[model samples]
Target: MPKSRSRHGAKPEVSPGRATLAAACASLVGIGLARFAYAPLLPAIIGAHWFAPSAAAYLGAANLVGYLAGALLTRPMASRLPAPALLRGFMLLASIAFFACSVPVSLVWFFVWRLLSGIAGGGLMVLAAPTVLPWIPQSRRGVASGVIFAGIGIGIAASGTIVPLLLQQNLALAWDGLGLLALVLTAVAWRGWPARSAPAPTLAARAKIPAHSPLPTTRLRALYVQYALNAAGLVPHMLFLVDYVARGLGQGLDSGAQYWVLFGLGAIIGPVLTGHLADRTGFGPALRLAFFIQAGAVILPALGTGTAGLILSSLVMGAFTPGIVPLVLGRVHELLAHHPSAQKQAWSTATTAFALLQAGGAYGLTYLLTATGGDYRLLFVIGACAFALGLGIDLVVGVSLSRRRFA
Candidate 1:
């Protein structure tokens, strides 16, 4: 989706701050509340006997499947429709999905609602940042982007605190509370969407080969695989963290929720801290180091689920969950330096790849969980190995580049 502009190609008069706020709210509702909130609630749904554990895990995967579909479809649909309108519709759709999920008439019914929420989330993810970033001054875009994505953290933190409290009463009430929160966020963002401006570039136009650009095809291929592996590596934590805490380690729901809260706290600062690190160390170094650190963090739980270990694991992994985004984007910018068009195109492809692998990984892990009878440790070990593999790719690519430069 293209940035929202006005007639005559003038920048939209919307306040950059307010527009940023709106986009943030969209992300919070679309991704934060709609997607991540389900993680904390998953154990509750299973505990309440609403669904078998394996069945509920599959339901969680359904949202990811829908997210992949939505990501693939959003740009094409945007071609025929106003992006702002579509964003608003998606926000509303997500809120409605929350309410629909509260009913839980059957497994299929709950799956469809979760899928709809995921679709809404994917639309918001694709459309929200692009729609508002143009309004931000170039010098301040970094801070603005961080603020917008922080909505995901805020939502995560909010769910950690709020869902547990709501679940105290009943599962239905918990879903209703989330729906109400989403509606409030939607209403706050209702007016800040930029009006449609210039027509979006055609797919073919965006995809046209840059005949003589300084593109690093070999390194880019490595980056794409690394990104996919990173997505897969995160599946265990995203879907099972709370459940592992509450059920796997035999901690109660309240204790598990506390760990999630720590995760949220880490998420809230992850982007800002990681972005600052990237600025200081350069994207390549920072990204490669991140892979190594994340591998260790992901594997911590499998090694020992003690209080200290879980805390460290939750905080570090939480930080990297959303934190990896800026690092990847910065790397893309570095690779495609002075090529704005290619940067955008490459980033779009990267996002699609991440979504595709994220969905696939979710289902893969879900099946593994069923096969192992929900062996949380095995999942964490597998996730850590993925990060290790990504790190290995980066190292190999770096060595190749060094050899070619000396030759």
Candidate 2:
């Protein structure tokens, strides 16, 4: 193990536990406050202006495209900056850009700001786990990761509830208010943030391997496939779940919103429970279970329509969807224990691939729905099959990796 030291040659007085939690919260507020918040408020924002709904959707896509770019940028930057500083800077930019969206502006301006927000959002997401994971003890890593990811659920719920309520009073005011709140949280985080000591040179040397290197080639390939498949399955839900309910199930907007509330609530519960389970069993088995549960959840909506079915599917899908990322990251962390450089490289590569897959899937599904004249059932079928395929691949790869470990 590498020796830990303070950056100033003296023991820096700071609480690792508190700092980790704060960082996680700041990251949650940073990345998600803008991205997730926008979806719920898009109708109001567009309604106040003359821009076409399609243009509004394009702006949403722009945000995702920027996220893809940010993921690419994080690869080179993560090693250069202190993780805490990187996170704070990104959060600041994102909050400001989100606030900028309050003004009724040209569609082009909205697109630009959304794209910038996406970049910052993506950077925060990629950096969040890697930054905090090092601070947590090994025994607590699973739980810690779960706690951090729960921030996403919290942020989504906050956005969903807060934005709509604020919009009821005033749309522009709502945007500015949320943005200001995020900014305040960011500043508090900056003040309390602990300084990160430099990691040992040996650890950096170990982590420097390229993605094509033989050591991580197999694991990296498997992870890419897993992420891409999962992303394909999830894109529909993230982008169109509300639309699906409203259009196919004949539910009103408020009813659709309630389904999202259930979804976010499930996300909050899912990670904590699954992380504990993973620690007890193993990541492979836990992941296999999550995949199966998620697959079932995806197909449930297609089966029937009622408040009961909608809520059931929402909870199941929500619980499993966000659970997969952290578990895979845990596996990567395990694999790269001996080689920190290799681990980081592998993570970045996989994350970038995941982002691209998510973008492609979102656009692809949107196009398909449009072409089919709002036939979401076809999309759901595709999503379910994709998830099932992911589950099968996970089982195969997981078994092979397990045997290799024992050997």
Candidate 3:
């Protein structure tokens, strides 16, 4: 939905630092803990023989399905409740979902909770950028978005370290422990959120995209497709790198975990660097550079050997994976600035398209991997190709957009 720019209370008083921190906490609880927690834990769950490989794959995917579905609910929810309330509610649900996963019920129950957690993660992601970005100064938006998004890195790093330690006690402890961590993060973020923020406007509540618009319908359609491809491209590394390192490369679990740490470190640095670059150079150019960089990163591991190659590859993939989010969001705002009425429509439409396709890959790739008998090479190859395709489309569309601006 259109990112909320309006304040609910007279002052909408929350310190920028607090707003950013709340946004980061949302990132932490949402995708960070909700999603990445699964990656590190996946091997452990497997080592313990809790479920068959195929079943585990399905469980991993169930969250993505729920995430896509939950994302669809955000704009609708926004029109009904204030931003802060919606965010708060989603955060609570996220924590509850995490807590539920700790319960060691049947596989069915675990999948259900994973799905619910994914849904919460998706909803929070949809709203967080909208909720926080508008409050910061324009010049600082990229950096602030980076800082906010850095929570993902922190979450990944935390999982890489904490999950392994927790698993030593028991799988139940690991899941339960993460749930508690989510609660702690939520509580820390609770007081920082404003009483209210701009509500998402329903389609009926806002001006419709004009029949004859400044941005062509055809161009927008291409952008949507490109976004979907981009979404699909990221799944391989984020979900499978550790598995690939330990299982595929025969590097062992500790080696895989260490590389995962490298990824987390890269992720922590990626957004701020890319955001600052986007600030100085412009989102489109920075995006192009990132896509190309990510293309190389995704392919590097497939080509290289030993710890050095894996670490370098993970570092690159980690940095570019989540880094792409804030950059694209900034580009969306920049592209639609002249068409004020279309801002919400453009952002919502574009992001939803991305979410659905990514969800498709998340759900589908495991089957592909499982069919290939857990050969992750095929998965990364597919991911790299997808990113390459996305980069080509972006380059073409970028040119088309520049032409239109002058035309």
Q: Please give the CA lDDT of all the candidate structures.
A: 0.84, 0.71, 0.79
Q: Write the per-residue lDDT of candidate 1 for residues 308-356, one digit (tens) a residue.
A: 9999988988888878877887788678754555665676677678889
What TM-score would every model get versus the actual structure? Answer: 0.91, 0.88, 0.90
List the pairs of residues colliding in candidate 3: none
Which of the two, 1 or 2, has more lDDT? 1
lDDT of 2 by residue, 344-371 (tens): 6677777787778877787777778778
Query: Ranking under lDDT, best-scoring first?
Result: 1, 3, 2
Candidate 3, which segments miss by more than 4 Å at Cα?
1-10, 198-213, 216-219, 400-407
Which candidate, 2 or 3, has the higher lDDT? 3
Candidate that scores best on lDDT = 1
TM-score of 1: 0.91
